[model samples]
Target: MTDQDAGPGPGRTPRLPPRWFVRSAWVVHRGYYRVTGGRRGLWRPQPDKWGTLLLRTTGRRSGQEHAVIVAYFEDGANLVTLAMNGWAAPEPAWWLNLRAEPDAAVVMRDGPRDVRAREAEGEERERHWATFRQLGTDVDGFSVRRPHTAVVVLEPR
Candidate 1:
């Protein structure tokens, strides 16, 4: 079949890392932060690179804290990230937790800060998506495989 007819073949873009690798990398990333005592494994976005931070949220059902390392950019004091499960159909668990409880925290290279998680809407989302695209994110390619991707904003609380 032609590439167009293939239609994401296995329902995921060939460009995205496999789900297993994604999960494994996430585990390693978190472990690095813990092993180093939070001295590493996070960074701020730069002109040539996407920044990453540790996002912490309280589970809606378990009442325990859940942490995930997320790539993000700063818009003033607010941090913006995509609610993408490594381009999978389902949103990341931390994003779901944020939806249930807006209050959260993030640890950056500089320090940790209390913040509130929110989904950007309308022009706001478009603006952030534009930034992602400009930063070389495969927004269009990966998005075609998923129903929706949210632009999550973490504002200081």
Candidate 2:
């Protein structure tokens, strides 16, 4: 379980890839979007699957724009995603920025959207997490590796 998940027997979680590999992948993914002028990077969320979306947030300290590709799904008019950081220990920078300034933007297959970010709480959090499980995301398994993770909800603003 990558020396993280706590369990009696063998952990169900798979060993995560190396940190350098994960970071490199993120850079490449963003590069692909820019190189293609976003013609090929954005994707739509499916009922039974998560989809890719480019989330843009303002830097908390620098006040500059930062973007990241994250997996998300529709929850009615809102979009929901996990701050997974590729299953790494550190929180994703995009999520950190959202925490600082809730207002953000996203580009999906449909078009761009302005959104306000907030943490899903209590029942809401459980419901969305359940949806992730149902979609075969193995969220619980992956989350065992982190001390805490945020279930972020992006409401249209």
Candidate 3:
């Protein structure tokens, strides 16, 4: 199997706890958002409002669409998200699904739109990293821990 297929190992186990935390927070936030009609503004405490966006990507194996909310940073006309938390691991499930099917949909606070997912590299990655660092203050120590991060840009279709 390739390195990606090998999945997480012993050294990566600690990262799992953080992933669980993020997932639980997402669940609670979504529930709160539904309860408040998206007015609570308790989802993400960041500058830019950085509110959660629901991304729908096709399942790699099941060929069905799966939707999940994630924190995102905007760049001009593109929407960017990082694979830093367990959700953003080198072999994250959503990232893998996007790889299999780049076309997806994103529902932000504004509205929903069809988008194409692409992994950012070189200068684009650097630019988004800076933006994320500027907007994400709650994620303390994220920069130190996830220095080598992958940026995924979603362009509207």
Candidate 4:
């Protein structure tokens, strides 16, 4: 059987690593932050390439805090990020959490701040997405794999 056709033995459904890896990454991030006391491991190094930010969102249903290390870029006072889940089928949990609660927090090299999240649409999405594409990140290749990808904007509240 092909990889996609393979099932967990007989009765069980296929298990995927993309979702599990999401959790694993969060664990590693948290561990590093604890060890470094927020001095290091909290954010990416300078000249952030596409830049990086620590997005802290509240779970929509569980009401628990979830943190994800997201690659982002600054747009004046706003921070922009994509909701692409490694070009996978489903959107990232953090994005889903933001949908439920737009109020969130972010950690950058400078410090942490309160922010509000919104999904870009129409010309706004096109404009920001173009900026992302110009940065030389593989936005097109991965984005094509999914039906829709959200351009998220975080503004300080």
TM-scores of the models, in the order given:
0.90, 0.91, 0.71, 0.77
RMSD of every candidate to native, in Å, equals 3.1, 2.5, 7.2, 6.8
Q: Which model scores highest in lDDT? A: 2
Q: For candidate 4, what is the total of clashing residue pairs?
A: 1
- Per-residue lDDT for 12-131 in model 1, tens only? 444655679988998999999899998888877998567999998999899999999999998998999999888888878888899999999888999889999889999999999999
Winner by TM-score: 2
Task: Show model 4 residue runs off by greater than 4 Å.
Answer: 1-30, 42-48
What is the Cα-based TM-score of model 1?
0.90
lDDT of 2 by residue, 1-157 (tens): 3345433335666556778998899889899999999998778877788899999999999999999999899999999999989887788888899999999999998899999999999999999999988887878777877778899999999
lDDT of 4 by residue, 1-157 (tens): 6533464444333434565796687678767876887666654433436876788999999999988777788888999999987657688899999999999999988999899999999999999999887777657655655788999999999
What Cα-based lDDT does every candidate model obtain?
0.87, 0.88, 0.70, 0.80
Candidate 4 residue-wise lDDT at 118: 99
Clashing pairs in 1: none
Clashing pairs in 3: 83-88
State which candidate, 1 or 4, has the greater lDDT: 1
Query: Can you give the lDDT of residue 41 in candidate 3?
Result: 32
